[model samples]
Target: MMSITYRLPQVRNLVTAFPGPKSAELATRRKAAIAAGVASSLPVYAADADGGVILDVDGNSLVDLGSGIAVTTVGASNPGVVAAVQEAVTHFTHTCFMIAPYEGYVAVAEKLIEHTPGDHAKKVALFNSGAEAVENAVKIARIATKRQAIVVFDHAYHGRTNLTMAMTAKVMPYKQGFGPFAGEVYRVPMSYPYRDPEGLTGAEAAARALLLVEKQVGAENVAAVVIEPILGEGGFVVPAEGFLPALSAWCTANGAVFIADEIQSGFARTGAWFACDHEGVVPDLMTVAKGLAGGMPLSGVVGRAELMDASHASGLGGTYGGNPVACAASVAAFEAVEELRLLERARHIEGLIRQELGDLVGAGVVGELRGRGAMMALEFVKPGTSEPNPDAAKAVAGACLAEGVLILTCGTFGNIVRLLPPLVIGDDLLTDALGVLKKEILAAG
Candidate 1:
């Protein structure tokens, strides 16, 4: 096995139907108790999860290719996280960093500054979620640059909060009916190689986007240009080479803060400490969450010391911005990343996934197989054309689910199948999951 630390068997086993009786009952209960807006991709309910397997309420052992939407990079129930949390909870749970600060919070911030890119002096502020981190990042950028306008890209997904909803591009699910979003947020074109006009170089894409910012948003008014180095909810879109560097150069020249929203692609999820490392592009501010604290809810904005300190004391902080329990979990999670060598593990998973699914491209329905490390995706399109085919993506995911593998779909077109297995997954389990995925994808074609 791939050095699985969890006790659960690293196997996909379906003791009952996809959503067995227990899960079906839970789904029935969920309909009545949960909000209609909160939707679960699968009807199954988890009873326990560890390593690469999720033992559902129905007694099915599902192969976890989704990794709780890329949150459990070190695996759920990681021993380090569990032990640290257990120790921390026994001592104290909540001592909001703003009131009685603790070493765990400071330690976590130190870890973020150490891992984040750049040799420049850096500082960090923790938060409760990705949206909070992003909102605060914008606040810091604005205060530092004394500009109001915040620039984002097409197909970007920042968060669901008001400001983030304004930053987010998708309208149907996240932003629909959540209107009257925060203003001063501008949208720009992304470096989408597959969908961009043919032969458009990364620099060309950068120029095109910059022209829009200059003409429409006014570069002088732009406080921050926020983007995901690898688009997360926007289909794991890896920007074309030279795109990021060009943007960074423009931001520096114009004094607009370049914020890398590394929520879904940071903390060793993309085979590196952060996706920005792939291109050697360092941001003025970096927002991080998802895999930062294993499965705990913790997020942070780490950036240049001056910009991060632009806000006066007591200007930024929430009631539970840095819960002691969460901070302990984050410290443990960072240690797990180092102890388990998850950065290399992410790359190893990437090689396996590419070896298995790389050939699907240009094979009728699959137009692209892209993304780095464990955060990979397959874009489904109509045969012989670039037209999106979300149905094919859904069909493949459904087929895999029926056989006890869980995968997630994303993209503005909803035509991408994303794979985000825990970094601690075994080779055998991942191979089995990929086998199911490949078989179903071929079947769909």
Candidate 2:
């Protein structure tokens, strides 16, 4: 391992307003060029970022807690990632790995085989986004299994694309008018422990779900059962222990593929290399993106060699499937994660979150504190019931943004607040961000 140094100076704000004058002017112009209804979570624009801090274009500096939706675990504006991306861009931006074939892309694929969970022989196919990785995964699964029905769990968010919209469970924003979705998609109940019936353990849920799948779709008809190791948009739902293992076992026996959507949970997000690694249950195929290339547009499908080879030659690939510049950044990100022991750092983040925020479940501010490692969330609820408190959750996020900390909310119920901080965040910086969150929660009620 080699030592890497990066600088992140927190410059004081000179303007009275958070966004100041310049950002406001830019926001007005943004509405003209961007699509209608498009919005941003963090209003304050970033002029620069390094490590755990965000330097706003308004000259306001704040500690970044969201890590751009868990994309920059090695930290925003990472020195190594920057250097590697710079060098690759200088050489050649894009020849498309599928066409010209570049080492940078090959390097990323090699890392995926080396780092992604499972000791089995695996192959990788690159893509542009998590959704792309997911869409491509389904294509491969259907091609391999010769089955049309793709089974996805309820409350899952595969993507915003047409096919994925049909797979996505949310109705309000993701799938309201975006009708006439892709065919052959089936939805099933997710193993949500917080709201599940009493007396039903994780294993029980698996049995029930398996029985349902067997009954409705018929195991042979289903191509693949797509799952998030820890459910992402479904409020960071951590299925009961043994639940995922049982599901994977059922898939294996039934001859249906288990596709772990680790887009949000993979690449050392949840304390482990992959959330499935915690249980030692490997998926037949997996979708990865989010933090794959330190914020560049890069995703991939890594699966058993035979399964991946199932697709006929030239059946899988994209024009920009493996952009060289993005692949270069991915190499740096992987090296940083390995050398910095980010897996251990993620565990420490889990401890801090469970301590400060998890304690609030009893205080009525939190109904559920679920998830693993850096990929944790707190669900707000009206006291003494399972009813969601979406307003309170939204308020908490709003207050955090006002204080210059960005937090994201998810869940089909829209009552869960999630944290996806950088893996390289300092102990004090992380503790302070958590303290800010605690204060807002306490003040909300």
Candidate 3:
């Protein structure tokens, strides 16, 4: 028997079906919540979580393959994380760092500078979410370059804020009818290798993008070219090696700041501290948030000292940007990553996903299998056709959920099945989750 501490996370089923009697009763209350627009895509109602399994209020245990949208790299309900949160909660809940400031905030910033890529003198500004970090990165760029135009890429997802909405690309939910966005924002075609015209290498793709920027937007007038080193909401797009380097070089040559939105790809998600490390192309600035606090709301823009200092002293702060409790949690999370050797686990996770689902790509049911380390996806399509098969992907995902595993869908076409399990998941648990996922993909065929 697993210890009580460890056993709660293991798969244990007592109810007749997934959402047992107790969960059904609470779901009625949740219906009221849904009426208020608070319900979520997954309705398991986590009673507890450890390792990788989330125990629902219904008494069923399902694997958490999504990792709360890649925020919990060190696992949900980790003992260390819980202890750190509880300790901080007892001491004080919220004292706005901008008002009085505290060591917790200072410590987290130190850790951010230490962990974030680049060996140059660095500084950090904390925020509440990925969107806020993106907005702040924009502010830093505009201030540093004294330019108004911010450049974004196609199919990108920066945030929901007015400014980030302008930077974001997709139209339906993110931009639909939410017009009058922040001004001077421009769009560029991202080098999504899977969809790019045949025979276009990464370098050629970057050169084409730069030429477009120069011709249309006048690169000299642009303030920043914001990019996700590994595109997150846009199907985990991993540009070939030469792509980022070329883009960064272009930004440097043109006097535009290169802002790497590392919110989704940073913190060892892609087998590196930041995906930009894949090509040794460090950005002038970087934004991070999702996994920084191991689930708490804490994010920061860490970058070159000169650039970070460029902003006026009081121009970059907010009331709750860096709460003391969240900062404490972030400190613990940073410590956990190094002490737990979680980077190796991320690489191991990539291996497991590839080993299990790789043959599906050749079978042609899968359009592509892409991404790095733990941040991976299997994009589905109509067999022998390039068209996306979102319906088929949905059916497969439904099957996985029914079989007691949770998987998430992504991609511009909504045909990609992404796997982002906790980096600390047990090997046996990951093997079981992948086994279920493989069965569902084949069944979808």
Candidate 4:
């Protein structure tokens, strides 16, 4: 593979103390201006980012391991994406696809159809966020199936909207005080091998979930079964091997739309274009965002032709659904994925991460190391026990940040530290980040 250049120096250079004077000022401003509900993982404010480094307002160059929550797989400031956005702005920014359509929107839809799983006839409807894409997918499924019930798994995170909040499983932050959630959204158990009872096979886990669906919410009344192929915010839990296939088959047999929320796991973040490709399980509808438009805000629901067209004309669109600039950026992102061979890159990263961090799991600091390709995680657990160790997770993250590496912690119990480094991250930078993470994990434990 050929080496790629970055605009910023790809090194973890702490010019000043972590959260230096400039970032401290920004934090003060943020406290007065930004809402308390909004939170930032790291306090430092970014001035520029490229490849694997984020140059903060304090001029501290920190290694980027979270990829801005998995949005910049191609790189934070990929040359192609930057140029595409610039060109698009010159032509015109927004016309709102509902009023006046543009070629970029249609072009993106074509790319979705060609790349997404299955050879079935498909159509696309663009949106502005992952939440919007998920909501629309549910809408389309409900309209087409003439059913109201939507089935989701435990440890699932669809989005932050009213309906998605109902779909989400965690209660403390995502759902607490956000009452009167949308009705008919049923939650079933997920196939969590690490936490499941001993000797429980993937097929057995599927049966357990299926039994609940049939007994609690009759299969006939179900409109859709929405799940993240690899649970994203829910700890990057890779479901047992046969679990996904069983659910897909059940949805097909029971006449329910199987929707894959690949918002964080899609594009080339995983070794495949989509996580469902791993199991050869094709979803009826797939919600995509995050990595879709490089760093631009864009999302979409790509699904079977008939179901996508079920909604009446003008029934599904937002004022900024398919922004032309976002679409252009998305086109460039798609090109980068192909031209840069990110699928192979992601696989290579998977090997490196596992080889580097697998020891922590054996040492009892990390309970499990799971996920695919560039989207792996380390679940912190109490020593020699399966109990969650959120304190360890927190400590490791803070320590990494103090040392000029950026890592993110997540999970229902917030005991998992997820690794989402840019696929274009340099080998040297990634190794340095992992070394910091390793030292911190050991110290925290």
**Which scores greater on lDDT, model 3 or model 4?**
4
TM-score, ranked from best to worst = 4, 1, 2, 3
Report the error of model 1 at residue 96, Å.
Answer: 1.4
- Candidate that scores best on lDDT: 4
Q: What is candidate 2's lDDT per residue for 151-178, written digit by digit as tens?
A: 8888898899998899889998888887
How well is each residue in 1-445 modelled by candidate 4, as lDDT tens digits?
3478778888889989867999999899999999999988888899999999999998899999999999999999999999999999999988999899999999999999999999999999999999999999999999999999999999999889999999999997899998899999999999999999988888999999999999999999999999999999999999999999999999999999999999999998999999999999999999999999999999999999999999988999999998999999999999999998999999999999999999878576789999999999999999989999999999999999999999999899999999999999988999999999999888876
Off by over 4 Å in 4: none
The residue ranges of model 2 lying beyond 4 angstroms of the native Cα positions read: 1-5, 10-15
What's the number of clashes in each of the models? Answer: 0, 0, 0, 0
lDDT of 1 by residue, 198-218 (tens): 899999999999999999989
User: Which runs in model 3 stand beyond 4 Å of their true positions?
Assistant: 1-7, 12-14, 34-39
Whole-model lDDT values for every prediction: 0.93, 0.86, 0.84, 0.94
TM-score of each: 0.99, 0.97, 0.96, 0.99
Give me the displacement of residue 339 in model 2, in angstroms. 1.0
Model with the higher lDDT, candidate 2 or 3: 2
- Greater lDDT among 1 and 2 belongs to 1
